[model samples]
Target: MTLLLIAATVAVCLMMLMAWLPEFRAEGALLRRWSKGGGENRCSETVQNVVDGFIGNFSAAHNLSETETARIREMKTRPGMMPVTLLLHPQLVTREKGRFGRGRNLTAVFVATGVSALIMPPLAGMTMHTMSLWLLPFLNTSVFFAGLQLLRCAYSDLGLLNMLVTGKPD
Candidate 1:
């Protein structure tokens, strides 16, 4: 059972890391473009292609209108606007109202995941006094990855809130 838990935790962490690689690559490309003096076409073709693909996927997922999609595509070309465009995406995407709106749902997830990640270790330590030492390390590693995930979500949420309030991405 302990080995199974460790394997599952490692698998999940690997999957999460894989999911974030594209965003990191895009950000790196953007930074490199900016450092080169922010020309209209400073970004490499690879970066442009990646951004276009991301925009297309986002538009299709959200079922955005033709004009809205065009606006976002235009936003991609402007220097420093790509981050702002992405930060404002949750507002652009439509979803049916549930028990909570999108922002609240994100807040709830942030709070729940945070509490679980923080509380798990100590509680487990106290309850599972006989737990193997190897299992404890795996548990801690999972919590650490969960914390990283929480930070990523928090950054996105904060960026969205900043854009909504100040009309700028931080």
Candidate 2:
């Protein structure tokens, strides 16, 4: 059961990695298409609706972000109903997770790994064999990307909110 849990965690982490690749991303098709300008007319209302939903939810928030920050979001924004858009979108795959957010993820991964490493030593009737157990905690970056992905969604949503309030997508 422990091995299974480890394997599942690893698998999700691997999925997180694949989601980071450019060719595999599925969420930014709209934004990519938008950038091309040829695909906007090609985008279905459902696509627009996903964008609309994203925009609506995004626009409703109160934004205190700066102009430059808002400009970046507006320029690089992806089309998705959620900010998992970072993981699921090709456009965002190249961007590293935000600051502070990355630190938080590293803290989580290492902390979880560290705690497990400590506990597993006694459980396994062993000592000073921390490497394998420690590695197990970081088996995949699911936790890391999940955090970044959620934050990207949130910031994008906030960008959307700011845009709506200001009468521009900025």
Candidate 3:
């Protein structure tokens, strides 16, 4: 049972890593550039340019209508919004008509992350007797926070899903 719990935890972590790897890489590059003395204005401009290119490519590939394109552009301007989140917004909005492919796969990944986050704490607690008292709390805490982050991503995806389905913000 303990082995199973550890395996499940590892699997969930791996799934998250695969889903977020692209965003992680982008952030890492941005961080490196900033650390190398890229001024705030320059960094912000670079981010905007990159986001614009992504939005343009995504819009073209998805054949987004003008209104959908405008919506996505507006979404990008929102404070603290991540460009990656917009990647699926158009597809999700269009999905109300029963057409979309890749977004479903991404959504599945996020849903799995959320389910794992809900299950991990109890699973970790069940295996607590096997670890050092100090180590158990540390491991549990790390897993809890990681789960929370994964849940946040899943929650955001759910909001996107809700927006398209119910025609309202979540």
lDDT of each: 0.49, 0.42, 0.52
| 22-54 per-residue lDDT for model 3 (tens digits) | 446664455334433423333477766665665
Best by TM-score: 3
TM-score for each of the candidates: 0.48, 0.31, 0.55
lDDT of 1 by residue, 82-131 (tens): 54333323432233421112454345434444544654465466446665
Model 1, residue 29: displacement in angstroms?
A: 8.7
Better of 1 and 2 by lDDT: 1
Flag the better candidate by TM-score, 1 or 3.
3
Off by over 4 Å in 1: 1-41, 78-112, 123-131, 134-170
TM-score of 2: 0.31
Positional deviation of residue 47's Cα in model 3 after best superposition, in angstroms = 2.9
Candidate 2 residue-wise lDDT at 101: 24
> How do the candidates rank by TM-score, highest first?
3, 1, 2
Better of 1 and 2 by TM-score: 1
Indicate the TM-score of model 1: 0.48
Pairs that collide, model 3: none
Candidate 2 achieves a global lDDT of 0.42
